[model samples]
Target chain A: MLHEPASQSGPDPASEFKTRLGVWMFLLYCLVYAGFVVINLVSPTTMELTVLWGMNLAVVYGMGLIIFAVILAIVYDFACRRRESALADTPAKGGKQ
Target chain B: MAITAFLIFVAFVLGLSFYLGQRTRTSSGYYAAGGQIHWVVNGVAFAGDYLSAASFLGICGMIAVAGYDGFLYSIGFLAGWIVALFVVAEPMRRLGKYTFTDAVDAKFDSRGIKLAAAISTLIVSIFYLIPQMVGAGVLVEPLLGIPHHWGVIMVGAIVITIVATAGMTSTTWVQFIKGSMLIVFSSILVAAICYRGFTTEPDQGGRVPVHEYATLAATEADSRLTVAEPGWEVVETHEDAAAKAAFAKLARDGRQTWWLISRTDDGVALKETEAVVVAANGTTLINGAPPSAENALRQVGNIEQLRGETDVKSGSISPIELLAGLSDKDTVVKRWKKASFTDADGGKATVYYPTLTRGNVLMRPGLKFKVQGTVLERLDFVSLMLALFLGTAALPHILIRYYTVPSPAAARKSTIVAIIAIGFFYVLTLFMGLGAMINAVINPADSNMAAPLLARSFNSLLFAIISAIAFSTVLGTVAGLIVAASGAVAHDFCDRYLRIPMDDRQKIRAGKLAAFSVGTLAIILGIAFKGMNVSFLVGLAFAVAASANLPAMMMLLFWKRTTAKGIAASIITGVVLSVGLICFSPMMYGQFGLDPTTAPIPFNNPGIVSIPLSFIVLVLVSLSTKNRNSGVAQPA
Candidate 1:
């Protein structure tokens, strides 16, 4: 319950939350892969059959969302790095060295 | 031709194994084949090892009868390899000594991690080995004309011999050979299908009545032979006028087809006694005395042969037609002995199609989860998934595959190859399955008959080749699993636990003996669990991998707060929790004749729950004790 948001360095617990959520993704994959075959043993259909049972909708959407989220996180990380790099490269003119 | 081909194939396989055994003298050679397998050989071996009979025969059988559902296993199995390639292969190669545990505990000096890992490796491997043994037993019964138990024993003995003599060196080359042969023969079978087309009957459906089990054992037999009596039961499926009309149109279109066989049962008393079909029209005479008409029944002869060249030219309509209305009882489809199993009440239940319904009652969940709506049900799914995601990185057999090559790069390359090969194979499963569905040749009585039956529809030569290759693939996979299990027990646990001081050479020697012991045990278990569904057992292996070993590996890689104690706790926790959930779930209980509801868990799968618990435990423990090994725990 105490796990939430994205906490890395600050007084935030979000970082812990992200890791726990990642475990959820892993479980979803397990269920879909294992459960799908057992289901196939019973229902003999095309759409349900051709498209792998657990893999069909969930994996595609889940992966797609994750990719987009990753891209946004990357962009934010990049901008922050750029600002820090510029700050480091700036001339020391008025500081009390 | 059959005996000659069989001898040649056996000679070739055995000879190849001997060559590999010669190279397996060194510890490195025995354990990881001196890390010198060519990627191409390993690549195909990977395919060969990965494509068990469960994949070849099981999936094909599923596809042939169950429509699309059968190919579903192929897809799921292959997709797992994709994860192995992209995410795990190279990273796993960089970690561990003998088992997956070695990798996780690399950062921590913890006995708990060692024990937990050793146990996981043992559990997954033994479970995995059972299926291979079961498949072997099944194949041998038909080929060698032995009992199922005998067949299982033969496989066990053969596998142990191979593993004991050569270690990983022999194991890898065996896998390499088995892998190559399986694919090559499978391709040949596919070609035969394309060239000769399909058959209504192998031996032209002219099995001049072999004394198989079913014909004689109207009474239950004391043995499990590959063959049973043949009699097609009829399944009456509902078809509305509209649907019937559509079917009629489809038939009229010439593309829609039907085939039939005229079967006459010479009711042999459960031995090899003969009774002939008599003319039912009327009794003519008998030795100058009036004979009873009751003794005569009309036997239908093949008229299609005289009716047209088309019937003569027809290649493969028989298998499909035979399966179409096999259970209506009204449709007197001709077949050989249909399989029947006796229940505990001694009620002789013919296992053949009294009904083929895909209802939940038939597909009831295994003992794997909390109740469907309960909190544990949700937790179980979560645990199973966690284990799967993490397990790939932790499987000892999978991990050692990385060491079969020179570097992490090669491991990465091998993974890519595995993904592609596995992916293509999965796709082929769909076609193989769909083809089986329409195929009339596949025996519905035996799900294991799917692939071989499909090949039989084409030609005998192909059937022989595919069956042999399928057998070899079992050998290869079993060998790999045994190697993994043996290494964990010998190198990690024994070397660590007993504190046995051994030179590198001695260590390797001990490992070989361990391999021998495990191989023997596998044979025994395989024979015992022969009746259990292998795919399900494999799923259990996957669950254990995902939960017990995965958490520790992940914590080691990313968590700066990790300590030896945390790693140990998580691994032990993951293994116990995941396994407990699975055993107590409805799936296991139903399988073992225990009350499903009596178990506290709901969903039969535990990966969704146990895997996460592992990671959580590892994280919590690590954070709490991070100060103890802040510098030491950092990745070297």
Candidate 2:
């Protein structure tokens, strides 16, 4: 089977790499997400607003997730592309394969 | 009147369903509509299905009532889409067959994987569907003046028929229509808020305070009313001097009088009975009677001002200003409280306290539990964080959507479109929520009425259109969810597990049947959980998806050491534990004590413990059997 060698491998990805990435990124997201959340815990800005539930804000709540998802997707796409192109030229890398 | 319009819409939806059902000839047509949806159209349909009545109505209502907190939910929800687009879209398309299970099973050929993934998809979709059904029930009742049960049933039959007929094609079109219309009408309502501008003045019919009251009887029971306001909060007035005098004599002689009003049946406004000041020692009387002035505490204050208000345009008020007057106790908010007293027979007599405002925390929890005061605290926050980080990537519907496209490029484009539409919609929700809060014409009784009511403030025609679109929005989403569940059943369980060597046509036909069954089930659940908040239900759905599916999917893709046994074990444990915990939690109970009948679990959500447990189970199982399946895997 056609596969790439290990020259381009990044730090020989550990079992915990994705898990750690998931954790840290999620932490940062929570911090940023708090801005909108704080408003709900406090108050709605409009003097004549429609309704409010605590920590539930309007500005790009779900869309914020979609955007982040898109960004990650782009990154994933690039990484996968690199790996696939590399694998196509070299043989199966010795380690995981 | 509303019924006629709703019925006509229902008929139109049904006719479309029948037309599409007849046209679904191929398995591709039934499952993924032969991978032919335009990115833009699919994106709009995504919006239609995702928005739902809770979003159109309840969220707006919540913001109008609760203020800033309501808008916060909107932000979280929109942000979650980012997780979906960038994380789950394109890669999922490249990997899976007809179902998310296809991706998992392709790697290991494990029956265990198929079973676990199928169950997880089914459970999450079912929980998510309940809220939609409930939303349908809420809307149908008001529009048709029919009870909530019929509303659920109606939505059910229509959705089942739609999915059973045209399959993904009809679902996509329905969603596309619903999504586009919801956004357009919502935009119109936002414009109206701008056109109307902010008015700090009281209503012409005597501005309804955020709270009001009428005495019912000698028993005290208070019912709180939700009011939308831009610059004022109403405090009920109980300044009837004549009635006070009349009741004063009877109250002193231990007699109680009754009054009448809407909603509360136990309200009794106690009058001029001499106030006895009991000292700290329980019964030592300091003053035998109330003060000479009319401004006694027991003598309900009539002249609570439209106080603490400024004339800033309601549209311009920042999130902070929306709830500014909420904390001002002198403004007198309305609520339900019980009055217990002794009777002539030496038995206790009770009355409903109507629109009585004594200071209580506006966002305070009714009872203290681990979860009661802690959603914003560390653990619950962690749970949500985990879900937000992973749920989008793992959602079955999202995974399958990727495969609908021919190439990864189409998936990428669709993801981009979804992001753009979703992002714009989130921005609009901010204005819409704030608009609902300030729209004096909005219904004060239901916070869920915020979006539609905001439209009504512009014009009833706008209101009718917005409401109709919102109903369709539910249909779009329900259709999508049913499609996902049916895929799991038809492709993963029957085709894979049962070893049924069916052709594409039979597979598609079976999927249609499965969609029909699941759709009906969702409708029944929707009716069962009526009146509960839709946002909360959505959160629960996210939690389960994140907890149950994310670990297994991620591990399989990212961890080279992952084993089929591990993936299977993790999915199994995650789904069961989360579902079990949710079912027994205090969120199911009305009280703090351990009540099995009331609680589904010990808390509201199980993400805190269950999520971690899933990861650990996966690791342990993988270690035991990691190398055994090395040669058995298929190429992606």
Candidate 3:
């Protein structure tokens, strides 16, 4: 008997691809979020400048972070579903299906 | 009317729980809602479970008082869901059974992993529970006109019934309903706020005079001024007492009195101020008079002047117009601050003074976070943001929601839904908070009532509905937390770790008992820690979860050299270090009725120090035990 992930009966073909995609996206988000924190620490006065649409950088940047998360999530979900179906249509290489 | 609405809401939630209770007899049904909840429903339920009282009441209240600093919480909180959606959701669903503990121990099958995870779950859940319980009591005071303790007990009883009856099934439905209603009603409230626009004379239709400062020329030490005022006399005077301001007690009708203080200036110019005195006998006097139908604490926050307009109102403006109006240089927003002192008769008195802040300053981040202050203050702000970003993926109640979905795909889809829904709701919080700040609806003594009070300013019916939704918000979050804690007790601690011989029915019974006990404990702590800020408490909870759970969970899933002993050691280290830092932190020292400045730890937040340390400990321990645990199965 071979050990398997607890929630699955057999191995998932797209598991490695999904993990790689997810980790890359996670790192990207971490960098953007860290930028928000660093700006507040290094020079918070920059946040007071009206950067866009007559709103301060603080308001613009904060709202932008929230809206950006939703966009990224939608894209991630779409890409993962495509990869999952693409892998499912191919025949098993070695492990029992 | 508000009471009626609150009662009806409670009845509907209770009835729904009992109806769902009939089908949840099996251990699986009780624990994970039979793992058949729809992706869409579970998605909204995730919103319901995540937007606790801290998000709704605490954020709104903080924004109403402190301006853009409060909006930072909204940003940090929504950022957390991104971590959940991209990193934790699919893997957590694929690796766990009932609780977060199940996932960490799935590869090892070690008792040490089970014990460490279970204790971590219980601690995080309880710490999270305190704020929801406290917010419930705060809502009850104005909504139902009851003491704070009674409200705590009432919410505790209702939530325990919800969790003990049908467990996850009823909890999920409650959260779904709450999530939908919260988003819909909040949208309606935001539309109303945009319609009202900004106004300079917010007290135009009021019966009482506006509580504005009155400046007068100081003549003699004890005698009346040359320009005497009727029904007012100076009874006592103290020179340069508070903040370099000379103080004088002005008596009215020989019984009631207000404060007349003058700041540092070449001339002696005294200004009349509002004061609330709490007598040793427990009676409260507002503005030198006992509160009654005629005399009460006046509603405070308002825009003193709108930009490019003199004494004119901007009626029915657009949402963008509202924000632009708040950021204009010429606009002036009135904010209040309180200073406390012992009066002549040994009674505690707090004087409320107004500062006319520039609109540009109000829309920026210096009011609460104090990022422009010392290095330690900046670190505290950054540490809090770090915790909020990392904490959501590690929360026990949130992690278990993945198990309620059928597959990793469902879990991933549901999390995306949660992010979109929760993100949109957070966007509305900014408008609602700013609306409350400019509408003169804020209660000077308690900022927590800002949102509900802003609704009341609209109409009685909207007020009643919003209050009811707020109460339901408390109910949903508390039920989710209780279920998570009970799962730790029944499944992780008893059945697996202790190797207790228990069937499905017996495990379900044990879970119910745990739910009851935890609920009772929540009630007692809620009443005990009254008057504390709810959002601050939630921040501490997030730090604990980030420290204790995240390091272990991420390592177990991704690191091949991870051992059971290493996971357990990291968890214990994270928990002890985070909890210890918080206990000795300046904020907790203030809560202990001591001088906060004398605390050993300079900062209040602990995430900057604890979270990284936890990861380091895990890596070192796992490397040392690599050879012994070589055969341990890695998670796929």
Candidate 4:
């Protein structure tokens, strides 16, 4: 088979850590999202129940999913930036030079 | 007024494109804005690029008509961005140069991968583009008082110029401007809606009159009735046959008249409602008269009763109060259901009949998604949600935006900004939709005009501004898609896969040519698919993207055993299976003018079946082709 060097840039010292962090967050979100789909599937009437602030589960959950994503994204960004900075400062420790 | 606003908006977008065009001399500059855009600007532009006509017009219209079912789309669409941010954003930025294909083929350098990825990119972009173009047409018809096709052509020509001239630089700035305007304007409209609150008689006190259906009392023995106003002369009424059978016959006969038999306090009553009829000889009538200034189809959508309020208007309220009022049990919203039929005189008629739904029901899921429906129906809802959640990360236009940013961190940060902006915009959609629902401004024949029409209900100036923003929404998204498609054609298909030798100048030229070609193709498809629900088409595009691109991207990034053949095979499988299933699905069957029930696939969405199958195919193919995986990039 013909071989070619990878066209992407050299890997960042924080790449592995970022991937791990991203995957975990993604899976965490997946579970909550799945819960939403399951509730809708099993008993749609549950959505009509007034849950919080006079809004039903449908509005609450739907809006919650959107809001939660924003929160998760902000947290993820802060964590990644902090880790990347840490790795940059001590390249010989827990990361490749 | 709307036309002038629309013209001014278009001119500003074009002028911006020309100003940016001067800097785009090199291939990289044209394709990725020299990879120097500010992360904040890129982020809002990302929202602009992502929020197509489907997100703005389709979702609002869906919410306006189906209540909470429309908000489900907003949730699903926003959730998909989570996938983009957490999974694809940084890696895509780190790997690719310009297009999504560049990122996927970074390790393999295989012609097969290029072919598959480019083809998938083009197909997905075209599918995504059609709805935006159609939405442009839909907007222009009401706003500019022009033919739908003319609007499609104008948008196509303008977007082609925008993309062909400045490429990514122009597209990104256009998106950023549009994204900002959309958020600001939508916020204003939502605030206005909250200020107006709930009103049982929204049309009273000099507002546009709501269309009212005519109801007449009838004895059980009455066999024939004559209606004078709506041109139904000597209408034959039946007592023994079921209502469904009578309606079915009327539907089959092309009759424009819709009659409903209901039990009132004073015996049985026959109701004749709003209809638009077109005779075989080409004459048109709305409510039995020619469609003149005074005889046009009136706007519909109003609250029949407000909970706990005998007063006609609730004056002003908070956003929470608005939601509370809509979900109240005693509040009844008057929504419409449409049907079409041919009459005995060879005239075609479409009618909209009212269904008074409780406020609580209107604020829940059963209106459109039918979560409580049959198993297949529920599956359809599940599949749609799955597609929306997975599709955002996989969409080629969105993926390409990652490359426009400088570093992987910039990609990540910008994506967060996009999520916040997009999420906030979607939340506003709920209020705008509910406001339109009770404001008596929905165009019954076309729900896609709901948001703009709702803006018009407040005043003409808001309407013009909202409509203009909507038109720019289409332009921004179409420019992004065309740029993505053109990149695939020029960089992936022609230069790499076909082994066509070209300099940077030639490559940019080829990309411009591809942009024009794709723009033309989008115009044709947009005009051809006129009147199809914009959101449904976007959902199908999402399904295809999720099925064809997501599995390959996920496996390649994480799974070490993934081979070039596997990626290529999975892409082909994803595209073919999703597109094939869509063709045989019930929705397409109905589009083909066949009985929807006779479709082989009972459900309309293809994501549930196709997405998993693509992943399985990728794994199986990768496992078998492990020996050929020689110099593949290790999982990051």
Q: What is the DockQ of each candidate?
A: 0.04, 0.11, 0.50, 0.51
lDDT of model 4 at position B556: 82
TM-score of candidate 3 against the unseen true structure: 0.94
Task: Encode model 2's per-residue lDDT on B104-218: one tens digit a residue.
Answer: 7666677888888898888888877888888888777877778999989988888888888888888888877777777777777676666554454423123334233323223
> How close is candidate 1 at the interface, in terms of C-alpha RMSD after superposing the true interface residues?
14.0
Query: Once all C-alphas are superposed, what RMSD does model 1 give against the true structure?
Result: 13.4
**What TM-score does candidate 2 reach?**
0.71
Q: Interface RMSD (Å) of model 3?
A: 2.8
Give fnat for candidate 4.
Answer: 0.57
Model 3 agreement with the true structure over B419-493: per-residue lDDT tens digits: 999999999999989988988888888888889988888888899999999999999999999999999988889
Give DockQ: model 4.
0.51
Extract clashing residue pairs from model 3: none
Per residue, candidate 1 scores C-alpha lDDT tens digits across B536-604 of 677787787777776776666666677887887887887788778778887788678676777777677
Candidate 3: regions farther than 4 A off: A1-10, A93-97, B203-213, B217-248, B255-273, B630-635
CAPRI tier for the interface of model 2: incorrect
Q: Report the C-alpha lDDT of model 4 over B434-485, residue by residue, as the tens digit.
A: 8888887888888888899888888889999999999999999999999999
Model 2 TM-score (B-chain only):
0.75
Ranking by TM-score: 4, 3, 2, 1
How many Å off is the CA of B430 in candidate 4?
0.7
Model 1, residue B321: what's the lDDT?
A: 31
Q: Pick the winner on TM-score between candidates 1 and 4.
A: 4
